[model samples]
Target: MTFEVFMQQLANGISIGSLYALLAIGYTMVYGILRLINFAHGDIFMMSAYFMVFGMVTFGLPWYVSAAIVIVAAVALGVLIEKAAYKSLRDAPRMSIMISAIGVSFLLENLATYLFTGVPKGFPDIDILTRAISFGNVSLSVATVVTPVVTIILLFVVLFITNKTKIGMAMRAVSKDFETARLMGININRVISTTFVIGSALAAVGAILWGSKYPSVIPLMGVMPGLKCFIAAVLGGIGNTTGAVLGGFILGMSEIMLVSFLPSLTGYRDAIAFIILIIVLIVKPTGLLGEKVTDKV
Candidate 1:
């Protein structure tokens, strides 16, 4: 491809990558604290879109108002899921928690299907997001340009919260030793709930941007992105926030470039994530930036 085309594709990749990074951060944070895969995370992402639809179409609310409500609802739903599904299983076997997570995912999917039906809904158009801006030979959507910038800003905010804040310190303590932290006076439930709230809010942001780009909402919408973001999390070092961002960019660029350079493989776009996951597992299971941890006997 020519330089201009390459640049355009690169921009597209970065835009999509930003969304992946946002979603991956949530996965990494939950794993960092709970060591739970949270299979329902993607379902939460999917639910955000439906929330937006209801806020806008069903309730006839303004865009900004609808978005704010969706985000709050996402946070509340995430906390509820944690409380209802995962909390009781905390002392149970890891397998039980995993099964519960998967069950929650399916339950949300089926619930959404029943409420919204299996048919897809078109994401409402926002004028600013749909508009295109040109930079000499290359042109891009407003959402494409805004997404990466927003992602970067949010990344720094998250890093600051995790590294510099008091709660962040508690989170670190819990991640290192849950029992020790609990004994030391840290409120374990509060920290976990905060993590879920942040992660779900990020998912809401991603859902908005994703709907802007793809312009479709469905019950199963989060499955592909959810799985891909999980792979991105693993690729970046499962519990490392920074690594999740890096993995997201790399995965996004690779997928975009693949389709751009070879149109024939466009159909296999989803397969790319699995292929990368396998490669990452075989070559560097700890991930590019993930540290190797040895379990104590």
Candidate 2:
């Protein structure tokens, strides 16, 4: 491939990677705190896309305004899901809680299908966002350049909040041991809700960026990204926040470069994740930066 073509492919990979990073953060954070898979998280991402469309078409809002509204609604929905479904299973066995999460995923997917129809909807075109800029011989989408910067900034902000604040400490305690944290005066519900909100907000950002890049919305839209990001979280070490972002970039670029360099591999892109997942499981289950974890007897 030519230098320009390679650069363009790299650019595409970075933009896609940034989206994966954003989505992976949500999955990682939720798992870190609750040890729950949150199968519904992907569908929540899908719902946010529809929410954006609804805000734009039904309420006649500007792109930015509609995007914000959709994010807020998604955040609220995430909290509600935790309260209505996950909360009840907090004291139950891990398997039961995970099953409930899976159920919620199905419920949301079917509900979205019923409400919006299984047909895909096109995202509204915003001229500025779609416009591409040229730098020397390299062509780049404005969204492509902007997406990673935004994602990095958000990652730092989240890291700061989780590392330097009181609530962050409480969240850590809860993640370590919910019952002990509760006994130590941390309000379980409040911390859990905050975790859900933050995770959901990140998912919304991913949804918006993904919708912008792909320009299509559907009930199952989040499935692939969600699953990929989930794998990324695992690859980076499930409970490690920073690892998730790094893993996301790796997965995103790998997928893109695979298709770019090996055009014949286009049809096997999804399988690549499964293969990587299996390799990671066998080779370095703790991930690149993951620490060895042990269960107390």
lDDT of each: 0.94, 0.88
Give a tens-digit lDDT track for model 1, residues 47-151. 999998888888988889999999999999999999999999887877899999999999999999999999999887776888999989999999999999999
Return the top candidate by TM-score.
Answer: 1
The residue pairs found clashing in candidate 2 are none
Cα displacement (angstroms), candidate 2, residue 285, comes to 0.9
Compute each candidate's TM-score over C-alphas: 0.98, 0.97
Model 1 ranges off by over 4 Å: none
Candidate 1's TM-score reads: 0.98
The Cα RMSD in angstroms, rounded to one decimal, for candidate 2 relative to the true structure is: 1.2
Candidate 1 displacement at residue 65 in angstroms: 1.0
Model 2, span 185-262: residue lDDT tens: 998888889989998999988888777788999888988888999998889888888999988898989999999999
